[model samples]
Target: MAQRELVCPEEMAHLVERFNYAPAVKVGQMVYAAGQVGRDSEMNVIDSSLEDHITAAWENVGKVLAAAGCGYEDIVEMTTFHVDLQEQLPTFLAVKDKFIPRQDVPPAWTAIGITELTFPGQLVEIKVIACVPDAA
Candidate 1:
């Protein structure tokens, strides 16, 4: 089996100390990130407006990708879980576009609307898969 390198940001040290999951992992040129929610450094999921939660989640994803030596443009796949998909998609996309402005060939995407999430009031979670060119 190929070895996978765990990707954890120093900012999320508290989560690592408590949980068994890495925020993401890198194998060869690919990086797979766990779903990022609007959680604080201490793992407190924020209960805020959808826009705020979405913005925070994307920022967290950015942090993880950066730690894994990847960038937004390198992302090739993304999955989003939402509490109210129908009502919030427009707003979510508006906020997401702010971060991913260039969509010439946007990553493959999947968005799921569910009745609830792990946290009662948490509204959004995002996971990503990205790739970098193999080293020379």
Candidate 2:
């Protein structure tokens, strides 16, 4: 079995310390990132607007991926949790497309609707699984 490595970027150190959970974990070439919300560098939830929140969440996800030695293009599977499914899905999709602009072969995605999230005003949370290339 491959050893598990916790992936926590410096900006997100507060989360790991406060919540006692790793933002992402890397085992071999697979990086499993936890749900990333629209939080700032100080871990404050960004809720100015749906689009802004969604974009921030994606950026947070990107940070976690980078810490795991991965990138958005390396993501093989993605799962999003939305507070307001019908009302916010279209906006979320638009923001998501910007981060993952590969129209040819995009990663597998699943969008889920939820009532609420960990923090107030946090509309969406994104989680992903990336497969990084083996550095020989």
Candidate 3:
């Protein structure tokens, strides 16, 4: 049997220094990523618009996937949380199209309206699961 590998980003290393949570956990070929928000590399919120935030969050997801040696195409599932689902749906799909084109196999996704998030201004949160070829 092989040991599962845990992956964390340099930014997440700073997070682990201040908090406690593994960014992603890999067991065999599957990777589970934590909810990612719209914060920039410095951990500062970058955009207030729904479109901007959604784009930023997905970009962050891409970063995490890259850190784990994966990509959007490798993702099999995604779950998104939003404060205003009806109002944000259009923007979300628009931003999503920029990343995951219709020609590609879009990951199975779910969007839920939430009452609140950890941050006051955060309008969106996203979590994803991905898989890669087994190393062993």
Candidate 4:
């Protein structure tokens, strides 16, 4: 069995301490991230605009990816859970494009709709699988 390396950004250390889960885990060259919600550093849900929530979630994903030595382009698969699938999708797509613009070959994606999430106001949660770059 391959060894696992945990990835957790300093700013998100509270999550490890409180939740007891690494934001992401790396094994071999693959990095798998936990679902990232639109919560601030203090873990309070960002109860702002729809766009803000989506953007914040993506930002959290970015942080996790960075900690794992990966980037948005390194993501090979993405899975999103949304509270309001039809109502929030248009706004989510708009925000998503900012993080990951349309490319010749985009990452595999799946969007799931659910009734609720960990937090009350969190509308979206994003998780991803990425490949770490080969060492030079």
Ranking by TM-score: 4, 2, 1, 3
Q: Positional deviation of 60 in candidate 3, in angstroms?
A: 0.7
Compared with the true structure, all predictions reach lDDT values of 0.86, 0.90, 0.83, 0.93
Report the number of the highest-TM-score candidate: 4
lDDT of 4 by residue, 42-104 (tens): 888888799999999999999999988889988999999999899999999999999986778
Residue pairs that clash (backbone atoms under 3 angstroms), model 1: none
Q: Scored by Cα lDDT, where does model 3 land?
A: 0.83
Tens-digit per-residue lDDT, 10-129, candidate 3 = 777877666687778777778899999888766787666777888999998888888898888888998999888889899888898788756457789999999888867788898999
TM-score of 1: 0.92
Q: Give the runs in model 4 whose Cα sits over 4 Å from its true position.
A: none
Scanning candidate 4 in windows of ten residues, the lowest lDDT window is 96-105
Model 1 ranges with Cα > 4 A deviation? 133-136
With candidate 4 superimposed using the best TM-score fit, by how many Å does residue 104's alpha carbon deviate from the native?
2.1
| TM-score of candidate 4 on Cα atoms, chains taken together | 0.96
